[model samples]
Structure formats: structure tokens, C-alpha cells
Target: MKKWKRSARLVDMTRQLLDQPHRLISLSAFADRYQAAKSSISEDLAIIHETFREEGTGLLETVSGAAGGVRYLPIANRENATKLSRQLCAQLENPDRILPGGYLYLSDLLGDDRLVREIGRIWATVFSGRGADVVVTVETKGIPLAYATASHLGLPVAIVRRDSRITEGSVVTINTVSGSSKRLGSLSLARRSFPEGARVLIVDDFMKAGGTVQGMIDLMGEFRAEVIGIGIMAESQVDERLVENTVSLATVTDVDVKNRKIAVELGNLFTQGGFFDGTNPD
Candidate 1:
């Protein structure tokens, strides 16, 4: 590759490393892939690391001991975070996103590792100073995204169950309203899973009426754990206020199934224009 192309490729590699920090890769791997000498690879990394330091981003540390490798710690400024949030919200707002029960489906986006990692990183940064002890969510579908958030925060996750299973052992069940139906339903948590006084962040796939979220709060009360934060992948605007300390990546409203038209709004996660570039990327 030409010199300019090589540098651009190096920057791309650096970004990839930042996205998956704590996972190490050898210099020889990059050198071989780029068809460059080890020294050239080292020079590229030096420039990347200097950019990171100048920007106050975390280090791209090179371990010198046995089993040494490079790892990138992504420290995105507020601008980067906001940009991502706005982009995600706009994508969710597409009129064709309608699902059953007026829900805006986002399973496809959640399954995209790159996008989900960005969302998780933004959440991790927002809650970095909150001293959260764990990330919690009710499961089946939310597990993957919740896991992403938990991975970003270096925290463990506890799952709430809509239906109790014998495999979970003894449990503490709570009665609360279901998110889909207004009627009350029972949810269960495995007893002793969380110790007393745990600070938790609640996460989920979608939040319609937030009945399931309230059920989690009730369960948290039983264990005396505090709900420090809540996040959902996508939320219907009709029920945004049902939970507090919540962040939604996208918002949808005005679903007319017969007309096959739905309205979506990019959520307020980046509304303050605090972290984003202050304009739509498109």
C-alpha cells in the first residue's frame, strides 16, 4: 500500500482495537496483514498512540513481558458519543420499523456487534461516574445487548425471568405489570443472586409500558439493591415516562398499521448535542 493508504489502514486498525479493548493482538499479525515490515507497523502504531495521547484518549499499551501484545482503550470524547446516539436514533425512526403491538423492532441492529458496541460504550461512559455495581435485565431477547453493556462496564449481569424455571433454584418472585399488556404478571429472580446494597443498572430490549421494568424494581427492593440506571435498546414514545433513570437509543410513535407508516424520532440520549457532532451525519 502507498504511504497514505498505509497510515489510513493503521488508523482503522487502531479504531478496531479501541472497539475491542482487553483483547490483545500481536504486532506480527498486523505486519503480515498489511504486507509491511515489523518496523513499519511499529511506526504506524506510534503515530496512532500519539494521536490517542494528544486527544486524551486512553493508551494503546504494548506489553513487554512474555505474552506481550497491543490493546486499545477507547476513550471517546462527548462529541463521539453524541454522534453515535443521534445516528442510532435516526435509524430507528424509519417508518417501516413497525412490529406487533406498535413496537419498533431493533433485533437486527442489536445483533450488529459494531453498532451495539458503540451503544454500550456510550452507556458505559455516561454511567462511568455513577459507581454502578451490576447491570440487570429481564431475559430471553435482551441478554445479548445487556451483555454488551455489562462488558463495557466490566460488570456482571443478573437476568429477570418472565417464567420461572426449576433450573434457577430457589427464587424470589414479584408481581408487577407486564410491559406489553396493562394487566399484572409475575416475574421471578433467583434468590441470593445479588447481595444486599448492590447498585444496579437495569437494561432491556424494549420498554413499552415498562411493567416489566417496574417488576424489576420491586425485585430489587427485596434484595435492597439500588437501581442506579436503566437503558433500553428502543422505546415507544407512548410509554417513555413509565421508568426513571432510563436511556433509550431510539423512539417510535404514531403507528398506523393499515397505512403501513410509522414515525420514529432519534432519542434524546444525544439531544443536548453534548457528545455528538451537532448535526445529522447524512
Candidate 2:
């Protein structure tokens, strides 16, 4: 058998593992495939894991106890992440989609099954093994994307409400400041909405001043669930406060009605890596 350099072989292995991170394969299997010593294979896995962490793609976890094996997480390589996000944002450039009050109409994009599924897949990839157990969102518009993301993660969707529906029976309600508003409004959660300690991914259609995001954050606390991450369809870049560890498909600066143009910029989520360059291996 021809011997391959450890660096080259490790890169190749990383690609295969990332393509299916949730699937586990034995160390012996990897060693046999590479025709390398078990020790060498283990070392290669370590190097790949370390590099992946450094790149913020995801984790390489070794399962212990019976039925244990090495697994790659479906985390995004920075470049792929950026490119995916940029593609979503670019769709906003259509002048026809612009609406009154500086809003960009995006129901058409969100309603597209393929685009929603792709967006969901990207979110799932980012939070793949970070232990997010449920996806949560407020009512109406955010439901489709939230359900799409939940489906990819194989998790349940928890709904927070702007107003409680009597059909849900008794509910828990909490009052807090909405994004950018000094006045407090109530956000409600249904009884048994989620099990305690379930990690949550918050999704929404748009984030303007973050009031809605904050409402969801507060709601999560009431359920004793932790927010693993937040994802948004798009963000109004003009309002910076709405974002913090939040990923958006695009950031809009100005929706120019008079000029028949919308000034959009790539959000920081894409710029940190991936979208700008193809440096990520997977």
C-alpha cells in the first residue's frame, strides 16, 4: 500500500467526517482505512479536532461507554457559512421586494421550501452538537423557519406568544421590556412548553431593535431552558442592539424607496470567516 503523508490523510479524513458528523465510525475502522497505525490515526484525529475548534466549525466528540466511537459534528466551516449567508442576503437586493417603512418584503423567500430548508440546514450545522434540544420562536411569520430548523435537528418546536390563545388552556405569562421599548408587554408561554434544562435555539423573521428577541430570551428563562443560540432571517443593520451571538442571513442598512435601491451589507456572522474566503477545509 502506498503511504500518504499524515497531514494530507488527515485533511481528507476531516472532510469525510464533516460530511456526516452525526454518524460515528470506529477508530479501528479509520486506522484500517488509512492503513496507518492506531496511534497515528488517533493523533490525526486529535490534530483535526484541534484545528476544527480553532476554526469554530464544531467539535469532534469521542463517545464513551458501550457503543462508543468517534463522531464529527455538523458544524459549518467558516467559508461555507459565509457563502450560505451571503446568498440569502443577496436575495434581498430585489427592488420589487422593498415595502413601506424601510422594510424588505421577504415572505416569498421564507415561503420557498428549498430556501427555508437550506437555511435550516445551515443553522443546524452551526449548532449541530452543541446540545440544542428544541427550536423556539414567536408566532406567525417565524413559524416556518423555526419548524424547518427543528426538523433538521430532530427536535421539537416551542412557541412563544404575543397573545395567549384560550385553546391552549392555562398558560404562563411574563412581562418584560420589548426591544428598544421602555414600556413592558407580556409574552406568554403555554404550559409544559418545554422540559426544564432543554437547550433552545431561538429563531425569528427579523430583528429590528431586539425587543422581540429579548422577549423570547425572557420567555426561555421562565421555562428554565437555556438559549443555545439565536438565528434571524434578516437584521436591520441600522439597529445594532438586536444582535449578539445572533446569526442573520443579511443585514440591511437602508431600504431606499426613492432611489429604488436597498443598501445591504454582509452581517458580521458571515464576515468572521467562510463567506469571504475558501480557507475552511469543510
Candidate 3:
């Protein structure tokens, strides 16, 4: 058996909690790991929890029972979240982001590892305690955001594809229509990816009219899954919105292709959600 000094043990304990968010770790387990007494372990945990709460990084939830343990919830501070949202809006307002079709380019932002991780932190914060068993997203563009959120939530990612592939082993596909152009499309999900009756949190990079988000909701129905919440990195304005109860970090109000101008603002995240101001509603 190996034992660590109190300071060394504290560092490792904090690292483990951060790395395995939402995972319950028993007091006895930590005691055994460090060859320390349960009292020592409890003190260490209290110290860590206090620091986390003060920093607004997260809080440690203590479950009481013979099988009880502590779990880390990766929640962010409202002020930090506000700063991030403002940065996203500022970055999105650049006229250079305006595309020929009046769409804004987001590849640059999505490619930034640090920015993507921070965005994932906020999504995890907003959707915390929703009883989500998995993080769901569409194929390709939404993959990164989904995985990032999953990492913070300690959940797996399930991707819905545009076309069913045989390699998926067994699949379910459904037809959907884009609310933007009224274009018809098909979405598919592997049957083995997640079990039936699972609870899911949908995460995506962008949304317009929410047709794709609607398609994903339909796909979840096939698995008898319940959608706890939806998180979008950015959502664009549309005349006919197709989905509701979505939280977004930024809102693209207008993209004038002829004038080479774009208008962006903070999304509905801070204004409306169960996690307004980064506090739990329940």
C-alpha cells in the first residue's frame, strides 16, 4: 500500500474530483486510497468543497447513507458565464463572419480548444441536476460540443447521423424537414448507442428555426428517451421557430449580406432557464 502526505493527497483528491465530475466517491474509498482515517478524509473533502464553492467552479454534494458518497457538480459562476457570453457576442458581431448566404461562420470559435472547453463548462452548469444519462447531438458539427459537455457531466455521447451506416450494427432512421428551407432530410441513430428509456441532454453548436433540434428530439422518441434539456452554442433568429426550452450562449439577431454587417447578443441562457444566475431552481 502507498500513502501520500496530506498536501500531496489533497492535490490528488482535487484532481480526481475535477476529472470525474458527477461521479460519487465514497469516504471509505478515499480513506483506503490515502491510508488515512475517515476523519482526515472528511476534513480534506470539506476543505476542497469550500474552495470549490468560493471559486464558483463547482460544489460537492454529500449523499447520506451506508452507500452514500460525494459527487462533484461542475457548475460555473454567473459573472464568469456573463463574461463568456459577452465575448461570444463580440466575436460573432464581426462583419467578416457574415457569409454569402447571411450565415455566420463559427469554425474559428469551435476550433479553439480553450473556448470550446469553457463553453462546455457553461452548458454543464446550465443543465446540471437534470438527471441526464447521456449527451446527444447530430453528426459532424455537433460532435465536439457534445463530447465536451459529456466530459464535464461524466456522461457518454450519442451522435445522430444524417445517413444510416451498416457499421452501426443496427439503426433507426427517421425523416425530417428543415424549417429553414423546407428541405427534407433523414436522421439516424445506432440502436446500441444508448438503452431505451434513457434521459438525454441535447447539445449543439448552432441552431436556426430548430429543425435539426426537432429532428433529434424525434430520434430520441424512437429510443423512448426523455430529453431533459437542450444547449446551443449559438442560435440564430428565425421567423418560425420549431423548438422550445433551449438554452443558448449567444444569439445572432441579424446577418445583412448586402451590407456586410451582423448583429449578435447574449443568448437566452442567463435570462431564462432552471439555472438562471448559475443557481439551482430546485
Best lDDT among the predictions, by candidate number: 3
Tell me how far the alpha carbon of residue 249 in candidate 1 is from the true structure, in angstroms, after superposition: 2.1
Candidate 3 lDDT tens digits, 173-236: 9999999989999999999999999999999999999999999999999999999999999999
Could you give candidate 1's per-residue lDDT for residues 18-58 as a string of tens digits?
Answer: 66654577887776677778788778888888888677444
TM-score ranking from best candidate downward:
3, 2, 1
Question: What's model 1's lDDT at 138?
Answer: 84
List candidate 1 stretches off by more than 4 Å. Answer: 1-50, 53-76, 272-282
List the candidates' TM-scores in order. 0.70, 0.70, 0.95
RMSD of each: 7.1, 7.1, 1.9
User: Per-residue lDDT for 135 in model 2?
Assistant: 91
Q: Where is the poorest 10-residue window by lDDT in model 2?
A: 273-282
